[model samples]
Target: MDHDIEKAPSAPPTRRDALRVAAGLLAVGAVPLAAHPAAAYPGDIDVCTGGYDAEYEADLAMAEALFEAEEHRAFAPERPPGRYTLPLRRGFRVSARYGIRGDWLAGHHTGIDLAVPTGTPVYAVSAGVVVLARRSGQYGKAVTVRMRDGHYAVFAHLSRIKVRQGARIRAGARIGSSGATGRATGPHLHLEIRARRGYGSDIDPVRYLARRGAPLL
Candidate 1:
């Protein structure tokens, strides 16, 4: 007589079995694991933490370097000389003389005004040091020429400055262009002869220049 063999019965999956299957599938879908720990972290966290491999880190470093370079560039101070030439050639017509406009806020016109075109070439009246060559709210673009006589000749309302500060200049040299700058009513040069003491006293430029052989027109 022969004996019969029995087959094992299949069992249905439980909740645990289903969960294990889902996890396996998820692991497979997330393939290509990163080699670095920073890559494993969230991108935003890496950036905020200054991660070297972060996308914007290089750009930030470059910007910082550029800013530093620009800061150093301005570190070199501008050294203007102590003197400059009188920025006018021939004698200019006087439109307003210094000390005559005392009613103006400037207390008094510390300089004489020369009537000229918008961009007339202004030459150095006398040779001296360029004590000042810069812009002022009232003087506009001005140049202060210190003469050998210990007096300061101020030329105001210029369009441009040709020489740098600290550079030596001769008489009749082109220093700047005439213009209506700094509280000017029109295109004119405000000239003033200040006695080294400052604004307290100023001599009449008209008679002074005339005596110096600058004929008044």
Candidate 2:
């Protein structure tokens, strides 16, 4: 008697197994010359693998180059230390801060009010040119310094102004003496940091100084 035997078929190949086969075939140059020209172009070859696509390869290379350059490049240095200093050195108290809403002020306090003596020396926060040094309306004897950083430093309510208009001064140089020359409750320094050298361009003076490494506590 003759017996018939049945055989089990092999399992389907995984994607990885197919890739390996394809890679092996490629290694031996199994790809036919009749294949697409793009696949055979040298520029289409991947930097990491045998993948094809000239645009993709170029973009990948460019991305890698950019990343490498950024990793090794030196970052921009921060502003030098001691480049800025407080307008007042010591023995002063903050009577009023910026943005205080009151009926007396035009909507809000444009700058800070440091309660100091009538003749406390006020210095330039940074190297700058004096743009205004005269009786500036409600500001009284004010000195507006066009600072090196482009922001205008307005020292308002001053009793004495030492700097003249268009005069270049160094950082920490005495600009005037603080007093209640303008609208104020008592003898104090009204400091305003303005984007322009006029009224209504006021920014927070304390915050600006703090950013330049000078803080008023």
Give the best candidate by TM-score: 2
lDDT of 2 by residue, 15-88 (tens): 45544543443444332222121112133111111112232223222332332232332112123323789999
| Clash pairs detected, candidate 2 | none
lDDT of 1 by residue, 76-121 (tens): 1123222333346555666554454333323454556677777888
At residue 27, candidate 1 shows an lDDT of: 44
lDDT value for model 2: 0.60
Scanning candidate 1 in windows of ten residues, the lowest lDDT window is: 43-52
Q: What lDDT is reached at residue 195 by model 1? A: 61
TM-score (all chains, Cα) for each model: 0.54, 0.60
**Which candidate leads the pack in lDDT?**
2
